[model samples]
Target: MAEAAVTQARVRLADREGFLAWIFLTPTVVYVVALVAIPFGLAIAFAFSDVTAGDPSYDWVGLRNFERVFDDPVFWRSLWNTLIFTGISMFFIVVFGKVLANILVADFRGKWVVRFLVLLSWTTPVALSSVSWLWLLHSIYSPVDWVFRELGFIETNTYWLGRPNLAMASVIAVHVWRLVPLAAVIMMVGLLSIPTDLNEAAKIDGAGYWRRMFEITIPLTFPLIAVSALFGAIFTFTDMAVVYILTRGGPTNSTQVLASWSFLRGIGGGDIGQGAVIALFLFPLLLAAAVLILRAVRRVETI
Candidate 1:
């Protein structure tokens, strides 16, 4: 009788476990289909159709929207700008992130204060931070300009966003600043995961700081760096709020990225079809980068 009861309980437990698995998975499946899959399907349909924000109606246009996008010089320019923006921002993010991560992992006084300061940029809302940056870089009554003037760095009020190059640089700087903290925290986690014994043994064997960093610390931490970079690239590639808030892709649309340009055309210009096309261009490249990064990370993990 006891054996039979034990068997019955075991069967009940198995049934409960199976039910819970489906319960946990059902919401995620529903969310992806409703939010992600449906929107993606609609965007593809819009890209091929003659859709407009003003009309909310569309007809089959075949390749017409794609042809129009290819014909526009702004599309190409935005593509180039996106590459430059994502590339440069990622470069600075990785470099500075590593430095900050090293500092974070070390034992020090007031480390929590330092960590909080570093994370402030990432924690703040992008729109609010962009506005702050805009104010700092404003032409008149700008603190940055005033400080530079006071320091004799420039004799005149430098229009940070009024010029094309300066505007692009300013946006890149802000993006990098925002990205580095997240990257730093990721790197810090990676640094912490490395076995402390190996580092100590290397030190005992007369490995200097730089030698240990280059030979031991870097190799182990490289996978984390790649992962951080992949996330940074995706965020920078898709983000529009920073550009929109800062310059609205101004100074002749010089800093316009594919994301902002898509918004400009699809919503602002009422050409939803072309905007969808512009937005979709990012999908393949981002997909490729993600796949490659994941593969590399997996390979490192397996080793």
Candidate 2:
């Protein structure tokens, strides 16, 4: 009878643990279903339906919305702009972030202060930061333009947001500035995780700084860098606040990216179906990028 009681108690304990596990998982499951899954389903539905602001009722339009989006040159332009923005931002974010991480990894006086400074752009609200950048690049009162004029780089204040190329460049610059800090923090983590003994052994083996960095430091840290690049690309690709606040896709829609264009079409232009199509375009591209990056990381790990 005692043995039977013990076995029953064990079963009860196992059941309790399983219940607790499910309890912990329930919130996350519910949240994803409600916020992510449900919205995604709605987006898919709306993309195929003729959804309008005045009418909650929608008719099944099939691929008509996507067809319209594909035919629009503005859609193609926005897609190209998004690619350019993401690509350029990723390149510079990695390069500068890696350098900053290397510097911060070294022991130094007031290193904490430097670290705080590095995080300023990231910690500040993006909208506020973008607005500040707009002011700094303002045509008449721009501090950057004033400094340039003082240094004779140009004779007059430059209209940064007025010209198409300049507006695109400014948008890209702000994006890079905003994203670099996060990249640096990621790089710092990668740098810190490197075994000290391995680096010391490399030093003892007569591996010079650049040689060790190129051969050992980079290869091991490359996987983490790729992760940072992936995140930066996603952020740049989906981000619209900076572009909206800075240029509103102005100067002939030169700075317009996919996300902003979607907003402009769907909400701003009051064509919900077309907006859904534009928004959905990001899904496949992002999925492809994520799959490729993760596969590459796995391959590197196997090596």
Residue range 13-84, candidate 1, lDDT tens digits:
778977879989999999999998898888899999987976887799999999999999999999999999
lDDT of 1 at 23: 82
Question: In order, what lDDT does every prediction score?
Answer: 0.93, 0.91
lDDT of 2 by residue, 1-303 (tens): 999999998888778977879989999999999998998898899999988887769899899999999999999999999888888888999998899889988999999999999899999999999999999999889999989889989998789999999999999899999988899899889999999999899999999999989988888898989899899878987899999999999888999999999999999998999999999888887888788888988998999
Lowest lDDT 10-residue stretch of candidate 2:
11-20
In candidate 2, list every pair of residues with a backbone clash.
none
Error of 1 at 48 (Å): 1.1
What TM value does model 2 have? 0.93
